[model samples]
Target: MAKLGAPPMPWQKYVSDVALEIDPDTGLFAHREVGLSVSRQQGKTELTLGAQVHRALAWPRQNIVYAAQTRGMARQRWEDEFWEKISSSDLAKMARIRKSNGNEAILWGRTRSRMGITANTEKAGHGPPLDLGFIDEAFAHEDDRLEQAFSPAMLTRAMAQLWWASAGGTTKSVWLNKKRENGRRLVEALWEALAVDLSAPRPRACYFEWFAPDDMDRADPATWRATLPALGFTVTEEVIAAELEKMDPAEFDRAYLNRTRRPTPPTDPNVPKGKWPGLLDAASKPVASSVALAIDVSQDRNRSAISAASLRPDGRVHLEVVAYRPGTDWVVPAVARLHRLWKPVAVAVASGSPAASLIDDLVTAGIDVPKDKANPERGDLAVMRSGDVTEACGQLADAMNQGTVRHLDQVPLTAAVNGARTRRQGDAWTLDRTNSLVDISPLCAATWARWALVIRGPHVIEDYDIADSFA
Candidate 1:
């Protein structure tokens, strides 16, 4: 990084020590995966670039893939830092830079090695046998779909390594939290081991993290330095203070102090207290007009809810929970029965373990659940993503506040609305079931129903008979 005019911070050097560690016996990277969790703007990119450059130069004919959550982020990193550094250095003569859209690559002509930069998608690293994979903004990736896509390519490469680097993410950061927790456990176990167990295999991953205590005073300079390793040099106290003034305190704690915010009910919730009640109309009933059905199972799978929403003649949306059941066993059958009764426009199901587990049941119930949006025969099944959930929650909240939503004032739905807590991801907010005091499945179902009603547009309802078992 210093040779490229961007010097590494002290913390970055410490990260590099572990990330670049090599096993002498195998002549390969000691850790197959390296995870680094630290504050933002702490010279993470500088360290990553330096590592990439080192790999490109040292290993001949190696393929490296650098991916971010979005294409724009990957493109910006390639153009602004990686390309700029290479173009200014003598290394430019040894490589050929390809700037084609969606196929950006840097080929080391001498060694026939190549480095590709692309967005983190299911098919991002499909083509190449990657020697090294770098996942930037790792927290943004909620699942292992992208990793699973790349793992097959790296399986045969004995020296292949995957690196994940990011700051603290929200409660939805399941993958990142797993990595951190696993690393911490390994470290603790090793420290407590009094005798070497030669027969036991060594850990295949390394995790490095720096964070301030949850209760630390944000205004204290001592706490700032304790949390931010680059405070005195690359970043300053004044800059952080200004940022603290501009950002939400919880957000600041996550991005700067690297502290995961305690999941608590928001003081000013996305769905205001009285707004939901105002939107409720006890006399509201399901319209004969085109409607959308949404099914949601609680995280524990102990409860399931089926909700319906449709546009009323008065231009307002009417939403109501059709069924609130005790277990998931009856969900698919109930939905199949509802489909026969309503012949609705679409059935929206959120993507996660619950929905994934229901795919087989849905198939058994004779529902053709399309895998992707491009499927020509969608067959009334709409799989909602995390982004879709966020949008639906926001839309539902907005409609309630605007008095454009009318609910049936069902007890289960009312309880869900009252208990739902906001969980923010970037600028988007979704209901946080993990932090909610009561079941929010009804609210989730209603949100999805509303989303499907508005977003799916008008669809021709096909005649289909409900299976005898479902009936």
Candidate 2:
């Protein structure tokens, strides 16, 4: 990045570490889809340029596409931004620009590589196999037709990677929204499976988002510091304060906070009357030799819960809310401490839930939650997918009804159980934390812990602490 005359920021380098990782086995890109959703004016254009320029110079005969909101705007950018930068630099001798009216491209004669500028459309991804694809201003896209068009061409290229960079999108941004959700789930699944259980299949997407949740105090400088990567460089707290004063609240959120509003979720569900209180035993404790731990974070990112589950001597599962704490910064060290105290069979969390946010932090804490997709039940980090989540929810409800589970009479756990709500995942239903009246992290943590234990019954615990190596 320094060679390109624009030194990259820490966050940009951080994104590159994960998204640009090459798989040693395949000697190719580890992830097919790479995305970044962040606050506006965080050097996304420069970041995109760096990737496109590097790929063009590094690879031979690479077919790359850079699409913006429209063809005219794309061409304007190519002439004003990209060409000017490349031409003024040392790359001028090796580069060639074709600026014919409707169709324009940047060409490298020696490598025969060409980057075409276009408006993102259903046909933006057409022609010969695409080595790399860029969807600039990705939030403008309203549907998946372009992605549908891009997938086929990417299939033939062993090192193909599609990049999407955008600020948070509006409700009309169905394409970016789907990618955001899927990428979040994939990150959750990928880190757990790859880091914890190497034998598990890998996820195809790599994503990073630096944006505050919609509920955060946007007017605060602290909020801006957390979300805006360009702080102290291209951006400043004073400037942000000015933006807040001048801009509309929602627009300020979109431009500066990079927050998008979502449609309201389903109303509270009728939780099953499964003798919840009757199953509570003041003396209830896990008697199983091996333990399983689960973690959950609230949607607001305000609170977190860590729960343990193990079997009772008589056969019933024992569940306990071990920790309920404010904020998520302590979750990693807390889990690491617990793992040493109890060599759990699996550390489980729902794949697509808010708790998934912890996957990366846990990995950085020297905790590996690799996935063996073929044998999820046998892994150290049990990635509870939508199906697995629904199954676990059903299992918990059934166990409560059948009096096969015992829980310590914890206040937080009881409140979570009483206030929990369910939403259909497909044919089955999973806990809906967002729609619940009260915090549901306690219920979520216990449910996943119980499921992980039951699924991997009577396992030999891995005695070593994964986090200890880092320490």
Candidate 3:
């Protein structure tokens, strides 16, 4: 409902005025979560940052958290951008803003109110309890992980509003896709397909998605306006045109137009004809305490190669390969041989295939094939994988640069590793096709599982020894 006589805005209205109503009294929305998808240069970041500041200013002793993907981003925001603005702005003159080494802050105002800020890790985000939070580029995070990270900010005295903003992502499963299609359906049929009743116990949270229509001709401005509500007036036509012109056609559609292209279900890149590296083939010595395992699936016409290596205690990972033989079920038998010889506690198979039946077969054969979901919180399997792979990749890169890690005589795996280039996917790294061995995904998964069983807590490496096969 409009206030009795809300003044008209010459430029744009405030976020509170235009935002969905959560609570009727405070004019504060009580959404469990809020998602916003806007095209680039539409003031999404500004709106979100302003909202955080507003919340902090409105309430005294409020604890606010603004999180990006990495510590560099964290520092960039506080040291380079936000705090710089605060120091320069009249707001700093009016308020007493105290900041610590790139992490904490205390803002005191004339109203005798204070606002604090902190960076949160995966395990700690949901631990502290929070008043308000801002998640920039939320599409990149795994499902529910953002919620966990923002859990600390839910302890506000009055109300807590979590603001998430992003442009678009490549995958359909991302939260951004849901927000774009499901928030408000056009017709009853479309509604049935996309809409969820907001009244559910875990209500469909409020979200706003802004993008150009898929079919819109890029040359026409009118066609763009229909899709990008932020255009002109606020976003300005010139800026939008420049951005569109700069992007590739496909990328433009996905990022700016919000068009869904047939996603290619993440295919494994073509591996060049090459030899497999042996354990003794290392050009350099292993890290202080490290483990590596090779997984070969046994199936006719479905031989897959996967290798995972990680350091003990430190959650670093190096994924070696994921190659498949076109016609032969060699994976199962090969994996069995590797198991008998090396006794690796963890081996990841790409069960998201016909091979899933084989996983059942393996379980029947007394092989451990537990679903990844049933894992620890702090010791989450996904966390371990991501952490380990990142660490491993970094270590591997350093070794390569320093001539530390040498391939046993230059095998296919060595060639692949040498040719590997990192692709940026949000805050994480995805293997670019050129040097990929079989696939990097499975290797990453196996490394994470290995870390959970090995370096986590008091557990030792569980008698899995490849050294006995030395003979």
Candidate 4:
């Protein structure tokens, strides 16, 4: 079999060094466990693909697996783009390409290496031992089941090289969330119970997590460039200034800056979209028999907002927000005004932190507050009621996609929505700490809790369908 050649690109060379340091004999890296937390578009794909080709050429009779979160993503990224580059390259032909079943099974005879891709389904990933494996977008797969299920096959090929690459997800899971949460709790419990768990080192396992050095500097493109040294991809001041002018703040945060933000609300493009036509004007007419007020609080000191979401008997909900500046305690008085003006049937305040305090103060002051707790269970209900986050994000994405959810319509609220990031914890979800966007949940929770007032027509009932739905 012909030997595989070294990579020519700088990025490839760096990865080559890493591979050689791990498995020098085969000039291939089989990471028993390795994590690559890289910034977006930093040539992760290029390096990985180059490495795959080099390994296949250098090591004959080897099996390689490439995988991603979804089949479509896997096909487009690895099988389509990366595979094309490898097969078209002179190096690929040098190794001799043989295919069976329309390239499903590819054999490079000169190097005795074969490569195949499997969709990220349980059935698709089932296979015999593999000499090398690749996982893309590992962050997108929160459950870790993919790693658990797929790694066994690769491990059976004990002599093979295994590499797991991903842009590590935001910290909100049981494993990676803040140390105060489940991850830390688990460590405490295990140490107390077994005592030896922490001290002992397990064979064939090494854990390494690499994050950007300055977590606080995510907004700077130079910070991103530092994570990706091989690309020669620098965010020049001119390019950044131009981007800031053209892209919305949300897009800038998510796409270029990698900042997590609030999701855009979806809208139907076929409908003629315009201003809400002065929600207060509609409210002044006293057309509605009852009102449901949902109030969301701010974690940061700068902004506190209350959104009045009125639900008519017809089942359509209307939203009008009255936001306030930091250090201003307007939530209770606002509720008072809402009560006197709209005669809202129920008031709901998010049930935690300053919000919960506000709810208590309102109740003590004789302003009735139905339970306004932001129950994780309620968020789950929202998911079930509206389907997945992707489905909900569709409308927000649509308005952005269709040019309908614009700045002119509601600039402040839209901007707030753009700064949120969500991660699923064990049976719960959380907003990213770095995100400064306002949360609608406290208000939504208050609104959901006030549904009882809706049915009773402004009368406070201790219990209602909304409360019971999650109870």
Cα misplacement distance, residue 79 of candidate 1 (Å): 1.8
lDDT, each prediction: 0.79, 0.79, 0.49, 0.47
Looking at model 1, residue 379 earns an lDDT score of 39
Off by over 4 Å in 3: 1-15, 18-28, 96-99, 111-120, 124-128, 152-158, 178-204, 259-471
Worst 10 residues of 2 by lDDT: 462-471
Indicate the TM-score of model 4.
Answer: 0.45
Predictions: Cα RMSD each? 18.0, 16.3, 19.4, 15.2
* lDDT for 47 (candidate 2): 83
Please report the TM-score between candidate 2 and the true structure.
0.56
Error of 2 at 305 (Å): 18
User: Higher lDDT: candidate 1 or 3?
Assistant: 1
Per-residue lDDT of candidate 3, residues 1-471 (tens digit): 011121222212444454535566555565656667766555554565556656666666666677665545655665566656555665666555565664466465654444444444565355445767777765555455656667554745346767677776766536556555666542234445545754433343665665655434655778667656556546677876887788776677766666554343333232211222332344332232343443433223234455544442223233334343443366556556655554543554333333444565454454563444443222111223444545544433433443322233323354334344466545656445334433333333333333333433223343434222111
- Scored by lDDT, model 4 comes in at 0.47
Location of the lowest summed lDDT over 10 successive residues in candidate 1: 462-471
Candidate 4 residue-wise lDDT, 1-471, digit = tens: 012222344544555564545544454343454445444555567767765776676666778877787766776675567656666666565543343433464567776677777665555446667767777776555465555556677765655655655543453322222211332354456557567566553223222222443233444656545544443543355665576578875555444444333455444232222333222233331224444454555565344555544433333334445444454377667666666676555554433434554665666555642344232211111111222222323333333334322122233443344334544444444333244344534333323333323333323323333322112
Q: Which pairs clash in the backbone of model 1?
A: none
Q: Distance (Å) between predicted and true CA of 449, model 4?
A: 32
